[model samples]
Each structure stands twice: as C-alpha cells, then as structure tokens.
Target: MGTRLQNKVAIITGSTSGIGRGCAELFAEEGAHVIVNDDGSRKGLGEEVVEHIKASGGSASFFRADVFQSEDLRKLIEYATETYGRLDILMNNAYKGHATSVLEQEEADWDMVFNSSVKAAFLGCKYALPAMIKAGAGSIINTASIHGLLGGLRHSAYASAKAAIVNLTRQMAVDYGKYGIRVNSICPGRIVTEGKIEFLKKYPEEVRRQQAVYPLRRPGTMREAASAALFLASEDASFVTGHALVVDGGLTAQLPDSVAEPLEEGLGLFRTE
Candidate 1:
C-alpha cells in the first residue's frame, strides 16, 4: 500500500527467511511485485511467503534458484522480465558462510562462501543490468556486513566475500551509472534473526556481550534491516549510489566492548544507575 515502490518489479534471492524474506515482504507491501526466491533449500517456505503476501494484498510470487550458478541467475532475470516486462530492483541477499579461520578453513568452504555471496551478486548484475539498461534505470542492493568493514575474528571467508561485495557494488555503480542504474550495499551488524535467537538461547553469555558493544544495547531486527534495503531500493535514494550504508546499531561507531568496558568502569562512563 505504500507508493514508494508502487508497481515496480523486484527479485530478491535467498528470500525464504531472514533479511531476504524481510525485503521481499516489505517490497511487496510497498506495491512492488516481488519474486521471493530460495535455493530450494526451503521450497515450502518460499511458497508460504508468497501466500502470505497475497493474503496481505501484496503482489508476490516464488522463484527457486541457486544464485551461485550463473545460469540460474540468468533464468531468474528472464523470469522477472518475462513475467513483469521489466526488472526495476535486484537485491542479492542470498549468502552462506561459516565461522572458520584461515588455519581452520577449507578451500571448498572458501569457494562456496565466495560463490554464494560475491559471485552471485556479480551474476545478478550481469543478467539484471541489461534489463535495467533497456529501461534506463534500476536499483541494486547488495547485502554486505559490518564484518566486511571491520573484519571478523572467525568469520574470515564470509567477511572477505562481503568486503568483495562492498567494492563490487562501487565498481558496478561506476560502470552502470551512465545507464541510470544505482548500485549500493548495506553493511548490517548483528541482526536478530531466528538463527540469532537460537544462538543466543544456546550461548546465553553472548546476549550481554552483544548488548555491550552497541550503543543501542541490542541487536537489529529483520524489519530494521529491511527498512535499510527499502531506502536503497526505492527512489527515496535516487541520489545515492556506491555507498555502503552501515546499519550496525552504532557498533562500529564506538570502541570494542572488551577494551571499553574496563575503561568505562574506571572513567565512570555509562555508570549512571
């Protein structure tokens, strides 16, 4: 019912749940015909999302594809253009990675992470850009992460892939701007998804530890992350491009809690009770 993306056509990969689904639902709610995609890892879930959208009176459908494959990405683009006659928004949100250091990481894992995160974005643009160029305008949102900016302790592969995406987004914007295409990435910090809920439940200590670093004292919700995507996808960000808008709940804006906590205790910082 929002007009920000009224009548626009969008495709979001990895949309069975989490940030992908969040964007899919919100984009539909804003009147964009959304293509909710999954890697077939969650077939029923993808259909459930489409049904949810229709029930809510938003336009959406499901598309299953493995974004890591160039061919699959091409087909996805074709589906969007054939179904809707144009592609207005492309959000590459499908990702897979693990907490493994260089010493502990396997070559296959590294490649998988890169293929899922970086190559998929590349392929999405490769196929979607032509459709967008034909129309002379489009918005592409790549999901980077705070780990991409600050790097991660154990998230080496995922972080590296995200960093590549951040730069790739810039490169795409530089090359595609002449065609009126805007490319941008959002670097989210700790977002509260179902995975995080389970994580916190199992490792309860992380709850307080997570709350300490962020000025907001909490993790971000999917809706909040989706809102950031919405801004970059909609014409609201018409003048924005090649930007990595950090949505980290102020995590990157401050010192690490490990270092700052003791300093806080001594300096009476945040001591007000």
Candidate 2:
C-alpha cells in the first residue's frame, strides 16, 4: 500500500457507495485508517466497503450515522478520534437531491436538499474542527459540484447548496489556516458513479452527445474524483487551501458556444442525474 496517508485517520461521510466509497477505498490503500460513515439505510453496504478494504490489507471501519443530525455528526467525529487517537482528515461527501426548478420545487424538497447537501457539511465541520485543532493540523475536503460554479435547469436547490459549500470551504480555510487546518473543495462534472453508469447504459446516444462537448470527450470516474480528494488530504497539497479544484474533464473551461447551440435542442439531456 502507498504511504501517502500513512497513520492518518480520515472520516468520510456517506462512504458506502459512489464517490464516497471510492474515497474510502483509495484512502485505505494509501495507508490511512478509514472511518467509513453512512446512514443506517446503507448499513450492509457500509459493512461491505469495510470488508473490501480489509481484504486488500487496509484498515477500515464502518459507522452508521445520519449527516443531517448534529448529534450524529458529532458522534462520528468523536468515533474517529476515540478509535484512532487523532483526526487528520474529514471529507464531507454526502448529498441527496431531486431534479426540480425553484418554481416547481416544494418547501419539503428545499429542506431535504439543503439539509443533506449544505447543512450536513456545516455540521461535519462544526464537530470535526475541535478534534482537528487538537491534532495541530487537518485536511477538510468538501465535495461540491460543477453545478455550483454554473447554473443548470431543474437543479435549483442542489446547485445553490453546492455553491454555498464552495464558499464555505473558502471561508473555513481563512478561519482555520492559523490552526494548520486546510480547507478545500472538489467540483466534479459528470463523474461516472454507479448511478451515472446505470443512467448511461440506458442512454448510450446521450452519452456520446455529452462526451462531444467535453475536452476530454468522456465522463470522469469515481477513482479520478477520489484521487483529487487524496491529493487535498495529502502533504502534496500542503500549500493548497480554500481552493475548489475542478475535476470536470475541462467541461467548465469550455466556451458556451461549444455546447450551447447543440444543447438548445438537447437541454433536457443535461441533468443532475
């Protein structure tokens, strides 16, 4: 195993599946003691992830907790410190949202999206900060999205929450730098998570059309996203903080004309899915 994160203790929220799962595995492979956190709904999957890490000769443990609950988040951080004796990293990667424009979205939808995406990050930071301060240094990685940098239809709550997270990363960085804690975020575009893979299988033509717009001409994988998190958590990024590293395969760097004209007819194809 790599020693990039050797002897570090990392708490990754919502790490049972998708990008969170990828981060858990990669952090373990890098010799970090991983605390894989997920909600009770995915207890079995969380256990499976822990087992997978162990089989690969990595250290990992699963903790079921709801990110939206302040008490749960507090306990999650406590669990990491009590079990590992130090908290070196915290990746607030949990998110949940549905596709709906502001005008069409219900109050309940807004609450759910904000609580899961924005408020949960807030709570994670709130509880993890003291432990990190005690450790003398720490890395905090928030998983924002390209949607946070750019607007999209039918993603009002999700986009707004992500945008808030990006700024929150910056604000936290400024506040915690004195304490040796680095705060940053990752803005991913079209990552190939398990759910996205399923969607692509059902819409092969749409995939080709979407790929045509990106400079890389394809979607990114969860491993790629995990690598970015790994970088931010490692000493390689010692000088980096309060930065939203865009891992979008150059999607955000392109001019609107490249995709806008074609997207006029294919706008429906571009979604948070």
Candidate 3:
C-alpha cells in the first residue's frame, strides 16, 4: 500500500457506491483507515465496501449517517474520532436532489438539494473542525461538479447546491488555514459512475455527443475523480487550500459556445437515468 496517507483517518460521507466508494477504496489503498459511510438508503452496501477493503488488506469500516440529519452528521464525525483517535480527512461527497429547473421545481426539492449538498458539507465541517483544530491539521474534500462553474439546464437544484459548496469551501479555507486545515473542492464534469455507465450504454449517441465536446473525448471515471480527492487529502497538496479543483477532462476549459455547440440540441432532454 502507498504511504501517502499512512495512519490518517478519513471519513467519507455517502461512500457506499459511485465516486464516494472510489474515494473510500482508494484512500484505504493509500494507507488511511477509511470510515465508509452511507445514509442507510443503500442498506448493506457500506458493509460490502468494508469487506472489499479488508480483503484487499486495507483498513476500513462501515458507518451509516444521513447527511440530511444534523444529529447523524454529528455522530459520524464522532465515530471516526472515537474509533481512530484523530481526524485527518473529511470528504463531504454525498448529493441528492431533484434534477429540474427552479421555475418547474418544488420547494422541497430545493430544500433537499441544499440540505444534502451544501448543508451537509457545512455540518461535516462544523463537527469535524474541533478534532482537527485540536490535532492542528486536517483536510476536507467537498465533491462539486462542473455545473457549479457553468450551470447546466434541468440541474437547477443540484447545480445551485454545488455552487454553494464551492464558495463554502473557499470560505472555510480562509477561516481554517490558521490551524493547518486545508479545505478544497473537486469539480468533476461528466464522470461515468455506475449509473452513468448504464446511461451511456443505453444512450450511445448522447455519450458521443458529450465526448465530442470534451478535449479528452470521453467522460471521466470515478477513479479519476477519486485521485483528485486523494491529492487534496494528502501532503501533495500541503500548501493548497480554498481551491476548487476541476476534474472535468478538459470540458470546462473550452469556450462557452464551443461547449454548447454539440450539447445545445440535447439540453433539457436528457433524463437522470
């Protein structure tokens, strides 16, 4: 195993599957004792993740915490500290909400999005800060999206929440750098998570169109996004904080009209599935 994060304790929220799972597993491989978490919505998935890590000779355990619940968020931070005696990394990577325009969305949709995306990261920082402050160092990785930088149609709630997270990360970095705590965010564009892989399989044309816009000519992988989180969490980024790291495979670097050239026709027509 790599020693990039040797002896560190990492709490990754909503880590049962997708990019969260990728971060959890990769963190473990890098010698961090990972606290794999889920909101209990995935039932046995968290344990399954733990088993996989253990089989690979990495240290890991399962913890269930719904980021939407403040108490649950508090306890998650507590669990990591009580079990490991120190908190070195807090990866706020869970997001749940409706995918629609604000004009056509429900009030609860906005609430859920902000609560899951923005508020959860806030609470994670709230509860984890003390232990980090006590220990004199920590790293927090908030998973944002390219939508946070360039708003996407039909992703109003999710996009807005992500935008909030990006700024929140910046604000926290300014507030916490005095204690050696690094706050950074990763903004991935079209990461092909499990769900997206299925979608890509079904909508090959859409995949092609999405790739055509990206200089890399493909959607990113969960591992690619996880690597960004790993970099932020490790000493490799010791002097980096309050930065939104984009892992969008060169999609966001393009001009606005260039990006819209191929996607304009399909805007608001793509389904979440």
Candidate 4:
C-alpha cells in the first residue's frame, strides 16, 4: 500500500525464508508485483509466502526454480516479464555455503557453494539484464556478506563467493550503466534468522561474544537487511551504483580489540554502563 514501488515488477530468488523472505514481503508491501522464486524443495513455503502477501493486500506469485541452473534462471526472468509486463528489480539473494576451511573442504563442497552463492547471482544478472535493458532502467541487488569484506574463521568458500559477488556488482554497474541499470550489493553482518536463532540456542556464549564485538551490542534482523535492499532498489538510490552498502552494525568500523574488557577493575577503555 506504499507507492514506493508502485506497479514495478521484482524477482527475488531464495525468497521462501530468511533474509530473502524479508525482502519479498517488504518489496511487495511497497507496491511491487513480486515474483517469489525458490527451489522446488521449498515449493510449499514459497506458496505460503505468496498467500501471505496477497492476504496483506500485496501482489505476489511463487516461481519454483533452482537458481544455480542457467535454464531455470532464464525461465524465472521470462516468467516475471511475461507475468508483470516488465522487470524493474532483480535480487539475487539465494545462498548456500559450508563451514569448512580451504584445506579441509572437499572439491564437491567448494563447487556447490560457488555454484549456489556466486554462479546464481551471475546467472540472475545475465538473464535479467536483457529485459532490464529493454525497459531502459532497472535495479539489481546482490546479497553479499560482511564475511566478503573481512575474513571468517571457517568460511573459506562462503567468503570467497561473496567477495566475488561484491566485485561482480561493481563490474556489472560499470558495464551496464549506459543501459540505465544500477547494480549494488548488500553486505550484512550477523543477522538473527531462523537458522541463526537455532545456532544461538546451542551456543549462547557465542551470542554474547558476537554482541560484544558489534557496536550496537546486538545482532541485526532480516527486516533491517531488507530495508537496506529496499533503499538500493528504490529511486531514492537512483544515483547509486557499484556500491557495497555495509549493514554490519558497525562491526567492521572498530578495531579487533576495541571491545575487549579491561584487565583491571574500573579501567575499561570504553564504558558500557
């Protein structure tokens, strides 16, 4: 019921859950006719998302497709333009990665992670760009991660794929700026998605450690990340492109030991109270 994206058409992959789901709902609420894409395994969840959108007075439909496959991605783009008459935004938010170091990771695991996290974005842009070129204007948002900007303890494959996406966004922006297509990436920090919630339940101590590092003293939410994507997708960011907007609660802006507690009592560098 917002006019921010009134009459626009958007396709968001991996939109059945997590941050992608947040983008799907928020984009639809902002007046875009959304194409909610997810893999066939999550068809029921995808349909549920569409039903929720409709019930809330928004326009949306579910399209089940494996984003890693070029053929499937091609159909996804076609389905959007054919259904909505034009494509205005494309969000390549699908992601899958293993928690393994470079030396410990299997070849198959590396391939799968790259195909899911990096290749999917490449294909989404590849197929969506032509339709956007015809429309004379478009927005493409890629879901990179804070891990892409900084190193992670045991996330070699995920970090590398996200870094690739960040650069890919820049490359696409440079290549297609003349066509009026804007490309950008969102680098989110630790967000409290369902999976993350479960992980935190198992390791409550980890939660405290993570919160201490973030300047906000807490993890972010999917809605917060979605808002960042919305800004990049809307005309508010018309002049923005090739930017990796960091949404990490200022975690990367501080020094590694800035959040450390004082060794002696009443000697903290920065008082929390």
Candidate 5:
C-alpha cells in the first residue's frame, strides 16, 4: 500500500524479464505509471508482463524499441511524454553479449556489448534529460553489476560496461543536480531470474557450486533488486544520487574472506526455509 511514487511517469527499458521487469512491476505497484519498454524480440513475455501489471490494477503500457537505435531511444522518450505528459524516471537496462571470456570475445561482440549496454545508458540520459529538465525533476537508474566493482571470470565487456555506468551515474548526478535530475546505479549480484534459471539448467552443478561461495549461500531475487530501484526512484531517496547500491546478500561485503565451503546444514546466507 505504499504510494511512494504516486502519479510518477516512469520508463524502464529491457523490462521483458529480470531486473527491468522487476522494476516495471514494482513501480506500478507503488502507484507510478510505467512504460514497459522492451526490445520486442522476447517470446511475448514483455507484453505479457504489461498485462500482468494492468491485471493487478496497476497502470502500465508497453513500448518495443531496440535501444541500440538512436531513433528508437528518441521515440521511447517521446512515447513516455506523449502518453503521460511528463517523464519522471528513465531506467536504462537492456544489454547483449555474454561471452565466455574476454580473449574469446570477438571485436564485433565487444562493440555490440558496449553499444547496447553502456551506450544506451549514455544515450538514454542524453535524450531523457531534456524531458526531465522540462518536468523540473526526474530520476535515472542504471543497472550496474557486482562485476562493475569486482570482476568475473568471463565478463570483461559486461563488466566494463557496468563499470562505466557507475561513473556515468556520478557524472550525470554532478552535471544535472542543479536541474533537479538525480542519477544512480544499482550493482546487483546474482539475481535469480528466468534467464539465469535457464542458464543454470544448462549447468546445474556449476551453478550449485557457484551458489555455495556466497555468504548468503543463494542468489538474490528479482523483487529484491526492484525494491532497491523503487527506493531510488521515489522521494525516499531524494538525497541519494550517483551511488551504486549493491544488492548482493552481503556476498561482496563479506564472502570473499570466508573459505569457499559447500552448503553446510543450518549455515546459509539466506533464512532457513
């Protein structure tokens, strides 16, 4: 029953699933009118998410645009302004290119990764700023990752993109603070989503072993990350900007010091079910 974002107009890109979808749904639940922006290639999941929101008595609409296209990004902002008369939040979250390793990653793959990931954040802010300036205030949340601050075995491009986003968040906040626009980034650790779940299904043993090292002994849920976004987007975080809020179940904060151990009975990162 929290109306923290009552009447705000928000656009969340890559909202077909994962963190973006979580943000869109939670924003709606918090009384923000949401634009469910998707790249339109997912298997009807994006539109279905919009339907789920409306079905829950939350306000939402869908827009399909490839974030790599400048024109599409422009139209996305336009759609928000046209549909809602003002845009209060812009979430840059679409990305492609998950390579096995930096050495194995191709040049074209590197280009595509930055183009869709970091470039979208850069460009989305470039375009969304005007509308937000006109509205007098807005929030922009970018999806960073634990890899941004730390690193992973085979995520050079993704890690770099996220790292850049964290810095971009700071730059935007500093540049636009006078204009009442707040920009921040979220560096989520492992969040269990349909995509990750599918990946896990393909490598069950590795996933289980990977899950063991975390202090939480489990991955985060999408809703948990979305709730953090809700706080940043709402008035509750009015004084917060240019920060990367890590939602990693204390993994980054504590687990690195602990000996890598298999899940022991009663000793876990999550609450015992």
Candidate 6:
C-alpha cells in the first residue's frame, strides 16, 4: 500500500524536538508535506527535524514563530493554506518552561504555560478549523499529558493547561463535528526521551520507583507515542473523535489495590507487551 498520509498537508507546532519532532518526522515519512513551526532559534529542535525529514527523502519545511502568539498562529495557518492550498492535520505539540507547585508558580509563569499549551491549541483550532470546515473533513490532535487525566505533584500549571486542552478537544468536536473535523487529545505517559532521561538521571530513586510502578516496568518511547498520534489523525480512526487516548503504559490504570501489592515489594504490576 502507499503511505497513509500521501499528498496530505500537515502543520505540527513545537516540532523542533521530542514528541512533536517525532510526529513531524513520521508524518513526512508517510508522504505528507509538513510545516514544522518553532521559535526559529538557530539551536531549535524544529530545524533539526526538518533536516532529518529532508535527509530521509521526505518533504518538509520549517517556519519560525512563537506558538503562544495569536498572530504567529494565524501566520502559520495562513502559510499552510497559501503554500500547500489545504491543511489536513493540525498537531498542537508545543510547551515551554515550567516549574514546581502552584504556590511557587508566578502569574507570569502561569500565563506563559497557559499561553503556550492551552492558548496555542485554541488558536491552532481557531485558525485551522475553517480550512477543515471548508475541506469537509480534517483532524486536530492535541498533545496532552497523563497529568491532564489525573493529579500529579509539582505540575499545577502544566496539568491545568493540559486539562483545558482535553476539554477543548471535546468542545471542538461538538462544535465542528458537523463540519467534518475530528478533534481528539492524546495523554502521553512517562516516556523516556533525551530531556526526560537527563532529568530522571538527576533522581535515580524516583526513576527506579516509577519504573517499578509502571505495569510495563519501563518508560515509553517518543516514536510509540507518535504512532498513536498518526492513528488518531488518519482515516483509520475516522469514526473516533472527542476522545482522550491515554498512552501511559498502564500507569494510569494502576489502582490502589493493584499497586498495593507491588508497592509493598517496591515494584509495580510488571506486565509485558
């Protein structure tokens, strides 16, 4: 069979690296023309991924813009329509600096997080929805986190923003479903990427404890999460919309009784794939 995304035009925000980068690469590999948006920093991950896609015989281009700004978002959307003539997939996958608990989070910090995470998604949908509506069908995939589905310590702003994204997904589905646009959110669990791996290295005990508690007894990979995103944005999930697909390696599924036994032994459910 040919690529699942052949001839499709996609816009993936914050795709300089990490999960967003993976999505951009995968989409381009499957034959979609991708617009990689980032802050245009010379050292940004977006440029790197664009290079990766181009080197792999895929078609992609980069746009430097801050996702938090409405103008920037509008520009990106307009660029897609003007250049590619249609926008098929819109993936909101950008995040910025955040810190500990709500008490420690400043007003500026909170604004920064919300603008980057929640506001960005809102603007992406706001601008891209019309194109989808006109085209008669499209996919909008918001990158949420397991924290959005449940509580976690020292992640108030990120959690709140992500929770908003999940709700926004539902609301968009309700409002735009009639227009043939499918909206959904993906809640990714603990996945070991370069940043996370380095962060975890600073806390060996916590990493070990997390590994033990996960049913898979390990963290996930960026590519695995990207694959799930692909499925949501593809015709394979044509009938699926307004859903929060949690890819947490069973971490969120571990209940009190389920974890009591494992916790007692300093291990988790330890299931295999």
Cα lDDT computed for each candidate against the true fold:
0.89, 0.90, 0.90, 0.89, 0.86, 0.87
Model 6 over residues 7-43: C-alpha lDDT tens digits? Answer: 8999999888789888888888888999998987646
lDDT of 1: 0.89
Q: Model 3, range 184-242, lDDT digits (tens) per residue?
A: 99999888888888887887787767666777767789899999999999999999999
RMSD of 3: 3.6
Tens-place lDDT digits, model 5, residues 59-133: 989888899999999999999898888999999988887655877988888899899989988888899999888
**Clash pairs for candidate 5:** 216-269
Relative to the true structure, candidate 3 reaches a TM of 0.94
Quote model 5's TM-score. Answer: 0.92
Q: What digit string (tens of lDDT, one per residue) describes model 4 on residues 151-176?
A: 98989888988999999999999999
On TM-score, who's better, 5 or 6? Answer: 6
Question: How well does model 6 score by local distance difference test?
Answer: 0.87
Judging by lDDT, tell me the better candidate of 3 and 4.
3
lDDT of 2 by residue, 85-200 (tens): 88999999998767589789888888888999789999999999998888789999999999999998899888988999999999999999999999999999988898888888
List ranges where model 6 is wrong by over 4 Å. 42-45, 267-273
